[model samples]
Target: MADWNAGQYLKFEDERTRPSVDLLRRVPLSDPQSCADIGCGPGNSTELLVERFQNARVIGLDSSPAMLSKARERLPGLTFVEADIATWQPEERFDLIFANAVLQWVPDHPGLLARLVSFLKQGGCLAVQMPDNLDEPSHRLMEKVAHEGPWASRLTSASAAREKIGSFEDCYAWLQQAGCAIDLWQTTYVHPLEGAGAIIEWFKSTGLKPYLDLLAPEERVEYLRHYMEEIAKAYPAQADGKVLLRFPRRFFVAQRM
Candidate 1:
């Protein structure tokens, strides 16, 4: 995958950061001396960590250099490291290892999460949040469009197979096996968006990026046009001409024993 565009991702910063803020609030840690923000993109969520854990030595870790660069520029006082959360290991354990809107990109939740738990010191916690909206219309439309058109082959092979995150029950068991006391829950946020194909714009920065990136310039425009036609039917406008996007996310906090 190409490096994420920090500027593009920040366009809808408020909507994207809400889940992070909500997830951070559920963390039961009162005074974590050391914290790591795994897959921390652009540090928006990391800022929340800093506010709550003022005394903690907070470090932001991300695979994208572009994202890490923005995180560093935004908070030069804080430490930010560029590394793949999947393979990257820290020399020392952390009191809190937090990941928001990130694990969905990585495969093998069972192994990956167990590795994360190992990074936490006994009594430390691993907090994570991931979008569980793959089956939602906004995402389904993308998959449907990807498999229908002439662009199907390229797009499907390039990026259409969304990461397979295990079910809620499976996740709880995964954390349980890691020897942690876990808290797991989910929430759905209905966002009212305006303008034509506002839903497409919402995904353009994240999910749509891969498909768009894989296409030719002209193909990109065509794909969006076709996608817009399909999604508009799935998300009709309200009386006020606004579209409501229902996004569901799952959150978990595991305290290592």
Candidate 2:
């Protein structure tokens, strides 16, 4: 997969940040001494973590320097680290680890979860939220568009491969196997926004990254145009000139044993 376009993907941070915060709130972190926000794009969620745990020393980690730059700019008081979560090794255990809307992009969910669990202090909390919208129309349409359109042949390889997203049952079981007491659930948020094209704009910031990167400059426009056309038909605007986008996400909150 092509590297993420942090600038584009960061646009949806405001919309996603709330849900992520709500998920994190479920974890009973009264006063964590140390915290880490994994894949904390642009520091939006990282700032939330800082506010939630006022006394904690919070660190935000991301692979993109551009993202870290923005994060640092937004949160000068907090520290931001440029590191790939797949290989990052924390020197000491953390009282809480917050990973929101990140793990879905990593290939090995189980292994990554295991590593993050290991980084937690005994009784430390792990709160994670991932977009469970892969099977939803918004994502499915991207696959359909890429696999059947003019760019079918070249873009087929860029399509997201079918992988386990770790359902509530799977997540609970994995946490149990890792010796954690877990609380797992799912939430579908219908984010209502003005304009019929907002849905397309949302994906431009995220799901469209890899596909757009793989295409020629000219083909990119064509792909986006095609994508928008399809999205309009799939998600019709309401009478008030707004669209209701149902974004379903999954959550896993576990306390390390």
lDDT of 1 at 221: 91
lDDT of each candidate versus the true structure = 0.88, 0.83
For model 1 the local lDDT of residue 136 reads 89
RMSD of 2: 1.6
Cα lDDT for residue 195, model 2? 62
lDDT of 1 by residue, 163-224 (tens): 67788899999999999998999999999999547788788878888888888889989989
TM-score, candidate number 1: 0.97
Which pairs clash (backbone N, Cα, C closer than 3 Å) in model 1?
none
Where is model 1 more than 4 Å wrong at Cα?
158-161
Q: Candidate 2 local accuracy as lDDT?
A: 0.83
